[model samples]
Target: MPRYRKRKQATQRKNLIGSLLIFAVLGLVAFLAFFRYELQNKQLAYDTETLCPSNITSPKYVALVFDKSDAYNKIQQQFLRRFFDDFKANLLPGTRISIYVIDAHNNKEIAPDFVVCVPRTGDDANALYENPKLIRQRWHERFEQPLDLAINGFMQPAQADFSPIMEVFQTISLSAFPLGSETVPKQIILISDMLQHTPEWSHYRGQMDFSKLQKTLYYQRINTDLQQAEVNILYVRREGMEKLQNKRHAFFWSDFIQSIGGRVTLIEKIDG
Candidate 1:
């Protein structure tokens, strides 16, 4: 009887040891699995751009939005959203560019990505749209000039959010970028109703006073200088009532596409 009891006690100890080993292995696996999950999530964070061979090396594409209309100033956010939905992912293969959507009036970068919905904050759109030379200069210096200083100063104390623009600039700054291509494609997609009312024109055509605009030709004409860009005017289409107060941004963005150096397509969608 004593020998049998000793054997039973030994067997019980063995079983306990086995269970602990199994638990230890499971805990290790669970820890490894959780660690991998975190790593992948960090890897897939929102990237402003992805690389591909069809790169144009344009100075860099800046998604410019102008929320300057007092008439639609409160509702200007709609246009910015529509712009993002149309082109954010469907962008041409190999085409990578940095994006910036600004409250053109305030010069504050309101949206960083393909943001579709934003509340309106009425402010005049500034014209320092996307010229690298202008960006390099001190923004406050822009106000010191005798020009429409009132319309041109920065709304917030921050200088400028050129990080996206600068990243591309550094990437392409190497030996002639888009390596084989002799010409670099440069563009600034200005999204606005093309309205300015500063009472007079400054030498810089796109700058507006934001206060003096009349509803007629003042807002009708977009800055014509886009003709100078290597591949200018990746234009988006817009049309809707001002009082609607919601971003009626059209998802049907077919009109704004151009090859690295190809002629700008002037396609437009007719509302059915």
Candidate 2:
């Protein structure tokens, strides 16, 4: 009887130990699974924030201003291709993108030549469940497909025309893009030669007297506060410009842009 009792106690201890080991293994697996999910979710949140941070009320806005006067060079084409190709990845749901042309004569009356407002389809919530392929497909169908068509049609080569860049700038700054919700951010991407070719202050003719121009009708009439917006200039260099001339051009634009509400974040020159 004593031997039997000892054997029974030993078997109970072994069983208990085995049960504890099984539970420990299960717990570790559950912890690992939860950790992975949390990590992935954190990554998704960060990506979304970097692309377009917004709240329940406000949405992000981006404006692509193409200078119709600037010749569409090889470098410009390459840059535009890359920009548009990567555009979908950098946008959040409900972000608006407007495409406009900077021409002296045409598109002057109209503020933004083309406007596209992205809709929220709640696809972002499925980031964990959906594969990359399906997500890409959804992006194309919703935003990228239409944008591709618009950009292709707009980028066709045209004669170098007069650039009413100041007028375009004023229009964009004053009323074209309104201050939507205080939380929303604004962006303007200017693809141009950074040369002002208007009658009031023509960079092609001579040096611009910014102080004198500020007191004139053209400047006073369109005083806009674009401090809330970020301006990025993808500078297209014109042929036959000396080093000094290019510096002057940059100075005129950078100063004028700063004088107004626009913040010049980047002034990158595109080369072939």
Candidate 3:
């Protein structure tokens, strides 16, 4: 009986030891998982650009200046929608987007009429969120809606007959962006026919002369500095204009804009 009791006691001790070992292994695994989670969070927090990067990146200011005189066709709609889709993806913390109209009466001023401004704010709290769906939802709710509304509003036909693109450019470069931050990226997206048809210079009447513009008071009046802003002119092709004329118009504007401080980056023809 004494020998049997001893064997039973030894068996009980081995069972207790095995249970302890299993618990220890489980605890170690839990600790390792927690550590990995914390490390990933830290990395994401450091790397994420929450509205403003921890590093030095200039604020981006985008102006979508549209010529109200141009026909708002389906092709223009598609291109603009595509642009907005890309814009949604690339939007960072310190980005501002504005829509303007190049109309006939600019209050007798050399400036485009302001339509709306969509500015992006940073979400520091959600920067390290594990789920990307929530992040996109936030962006769509805040930034995307306002931009879409502005575009829709601009798509409506205006009563203006003339398109003063030069004045619009000058206005945007001079007054649209904040005055103090010249180091930031200033982008002007022009949606027009690339044909300047103002009271001063009419492209249809063959009175479009760049040399005379320099000599006139209008040039001096609209000679506001762009501070090396980039211009992307998305020329909307009209129904009657020849292919050669369109090409010439694009080239003329490219050279004309570059003559000023603006760097004309794109001169694409949008067929409607």
TM-score on alpha carbons, each prediction: 0.27, 0.69, 0.69
Tens-digit lDDT string for candidate 1 (113-161): 3311111111222232334444324222421131122212211123221
Q: Residue 132, candidate 3: how far off, in angstroms? A: 6.3
Residue 235 displacement (Å), model 2: 0.2
Which regions of candidate 2 deviate over 4 angstroms? 1-58, 119-123, 127-136, 174-176, 243-245
lDDT for 65 in candidate 2 is 84
Query: Roughly what TM-score does model 3 have, to 2 decimal places?
Result: 0.69
Q: Give the TM-score of candidate 2.
A: 0.69
Ranking by lDDT: 2, 3, 1
Model 1 scores a C-alpha lDDT of 0.32
- Of the two candidates 1 and 2, the one with more favorable lDDT, higher being better, is 2
Instruction: Please provide, for model 2 over 30-119, each residue's C-alpha lDDT reduced to its tens digit, 9 standing for 90 to 100.
Output: 988987897575343212312322333326678888887756777678888887677666676757677788765744465667666554
lDDT of 3 by residue, 68-88 (tens): 775678867888788768766
Give the least accurate 10-residue stretch of model 3, judged by summed lDDT.
44-53
- The residue ranges of model 3 lying beyond 4 angstroms of the native Cα positions read 1-58, 108-135
**Would you give me the overall lDDT of model 2?**
0.69
